[model samples]
Target chain A: MMTKEQILQWLEQFADAIAQNKEYLTQLDAAIGDADHGINMDRGFQKVASQLPKLAEQDISSVLKTVSITLISSVGGASGPLYGTFFLRASTAVAGKQELSNEDLASLLQAGLDGVLQRGKAQLGDKTMIDALSPAVTAFTQAIGQGKTTSEAIQQATAAAEQGMQATIPMLAKKGRASYLGDRSIDHQDPGATSVYLMLKSLSEVLGMTSD
Target chain B: MKKLINQPEDFVRESLIGMAKAHSDLLKVQFEPTFVYRADAPVQGKVALISGGGSGHEPLHAGFVGRGMLDAACPGEVFTSPTPDQMLAAAKQVDGGAGILYIVKNYSGDVMNFEMATELARAEDLRVLSILIDDDVAVKDSLYTQGRRGVGTTVLAEKICGAAAEKGYDLADIADLCRRVNLNGRSMGVALTSCTVPAIMKPTFELDADEIEMGIGIHGEPGRERMTIKSADEITEMLAMSIFEDIVYTRTVREWDESKGGFVDVQLTNPEWEKGDRLLAFVNGMGGTPLAELYIVYRQLADLCAQQGWQIVRNLIGSYITSLDMQGCSITLLRLDDEMIRLWDAPVKTASWRWGS
Candidate 1:
């Protein structure tokens, strides 16, 4: 069971992952976006850092909700709203629960994607964060249905997210300013998808059953 | 990559200070808490007109701050919406006892934050009216993000509505005029090159040299289409045709008194060039396009207007507003009448703006 403490740790880790990969993300964004992907994601998670102490004692849902609001308000640009919506939906998915069950985790992940879609209005082929998130969510569902443990399902989801992120390199963007490039939008990596992959990567590394 | 700045973070503040220094006779920079206000603002008995958004969209919201445009404009970080705290401060400081009117673009954060500021001001018993400008005929309306965006047309809305306010129109009348301008104007943009935000340190998006993205948002959000780069005439035709279609299909200029007239017989006045009744033309730059290029576009548009049998009355040919360093321009026309022409000619002083002053 992932305790609320573990959840906090994961949030902190999420922030850390963004900080560590900030430059890489920005480099990718230089191609498809305004090159603020890493900067915004880093700034948003950093703000999420200050709230950690206050969030530590709260319910997991409450803590995540705070992160969502902070991100939406401070992160700015398109990424702020996208990541903000993700956490808000994640919080809703885990509502009234102290810790997530295996099924609960999958539902929460799916719910987060739903929030992303609701906010960004991006879809699978749009070459946005949805590309990474949708694939990850599908993988999680499939793995869990195959009787994989919670840890195993997360690993599968993480791999799928990474693959989905990779797949964005060749697809043309149909949403956002990047879409303005039309066919030229292809070949460059989607920054939102890259960040989503990082998010799933953290999940898999932190909670997956490595032994399995 | 070498920009005229000491530090990227301090760009907006330092630039505002320079603007205030250079145009102190017309513009005043509020220190400590930041914003750009007209030196003649808080006009005793008049309603305050406020508009602001992100910083990279320069000369907009700020360049329009003057006698006939904005009373005050709050600047936020690059391409980011200003906070409610900033908006509230502007709302309070610019209140002239009559009331305050907010001209907000139809972006998500801007709308939410401006709405919050309006609510907060209401708590203080200040009468505030707001008109959301959603004039871009690009993005489809959705339950999440607002439909279309406030784009080049914001300049026309601000100028026209600011004129109404200058005429001592009441808050309600000014609000109605603003809404009317919003209804009348439509804009579409094409980007030849992507612009880079200083903080972001890279182009907002990628656009190949050989192609152009049509229907792009000022935020550098992905556009709807990418087509082969076309000639100035072809591009002008596409953009102007889109705007005309929006005006016609939206029925923005339908005859109010069908019994009195067929189509609205409008007359353009305050002619920038002595000519017959054509229309008001604005050949605006998308930040990086040169004035010479813009004039070339103006020539094409003037030809277009001549071809349409529309007399070119008043024409503004320059970058009145910009979208960072994107290399392109937009064509905007306000089909005006006698009153609008008088209002357009009204003297106004502001940062990077002076008309009949």
Candidate 2:
């Protein structure tokens, strides 16, 4: 079971990952996007970081909901609504649960992915966060179904997410600003997909520490 | 970035504060989710027009907020679309009991945010309608890309739709008028240099001195292709022909259905332009380009229109909508009917644009 501290750790670690790679993500975006994905995500998560103190004692759902609201208000790009909706749906899925079981974690990830798909209208291979997130959720659920621990399931999910992010390379974008590039978008990894990978990686890192 | 900014993060907020001070007689500022509205807003029994987008596009959406223009304008972070809260608050502040209409651009963020705002406004029992302006022909395919980006013609739509609202048109009538304006408009732009987003403190894109990005979007996104620089007349012919020789564009967009109380998808097509069509010619600089350069562009644009047998019945030539410090220009040709022509000529008293008052 994932404790509330683990959930907060996931958010804090995710924010740091975004902060560290902000310029790199923006550079990836500069190839085929508006060159602001990292900046926008960093701005959103930084606000989330600042609000963590007030959310520490709250339930996991409350913390997730607070992060969603912060992102929805601060992040102004396509990433904003997409990520905000993800957390919002995830919060609903795990409502009132102070600690999340392996199955509960799978449900949370799957619900977040569903929210992203609905908000972005992007399917697999659309060169969006769905590219990474869809496979991550699938892997997480599959591992959990096989009776893997939460830490093992998250590790599997992060691996899938990394592969999904790399798979974005050579795919022509079909949505968002990168879609404008058409043929020119080939050979560049999607910024949104990269951020998704970072999120899953952060979650796995947090789980590895707590469960071990 | 050598800008007159106090801090990178404070750019949009400080600018709004300055705008409130500068245009105090015309508009007032609201905080939190920032928006600008006419000082004497909620004009009784008037269909209020609300529009907004990123902050760097000066004199657009916000500067155009005054009598006979937008009743309220929401400004987001530089080059980022505003949130639903901002739009929702703006609508509530300006709804004068005659309903409200939202003029949204076609970018994904703007479309999604405005859509959410429309739903929220409907939930509040506020009468609201929204129409999108996707006039830039920079992107080629609607099914493949995010369709066309809204560019120069948004300013024209705001002016015309704002005027229509001032003439006591109801929400539906004004919404239809705005849609018509979008359908009849086409624009194409070229960027000579990239602009810097204040927070990022770097140019969004890089262009070699000898090359130019053609078919540019308003937010400094790269265009369809890049080519070596050409003469004024040559570049003018290229940008103008992109619009003039463009075929019919068909795409699906969302519009607010008041009866259904939700958004419904509607297919829209750009009306093809033909010879002898009376056009409102707009030559807009992309911020860093000087007025002299814009005039040169306009001169060539006029010659080309005359050659193509199109009549320039009215014209607006300047940098009204811009990318921050980007050196470029866009040309918009909007087909005008009698009603549109009359509305375009109507009096508008805004902080940035004023005439016939």
Q: Summarize candidate 2's per-residue lDDT along B47-141 as a digit string, tens digits.
A: 99999988888978788998888999999888888888899999999999999999998988888888778878888998989989999887888
DockQ of each: 0.17, 0.65
What part of the reference interface contacts, as a 0 to 1 fraction, does candidate 2 reproduce? Answer: 0.42
Model 1 lDDT per residue over B27-114, tens place: 7888544678878768888888999888888888877888888889988677767655677778888888888888888665566556
Interface RMSD score of each model? 5.0, 1.2
Candidate 2: list runs displaced more than 4 Å.
none
Error of 1 at B343 (Å): 3.4
CA-based DockQ, model 2 = 0.65
Report the lDDT tens digits of candidate 2 across residue range A73-173.
88887888889899999999999897888888889998999998877877798788999999999999999899888889899999999999999998998
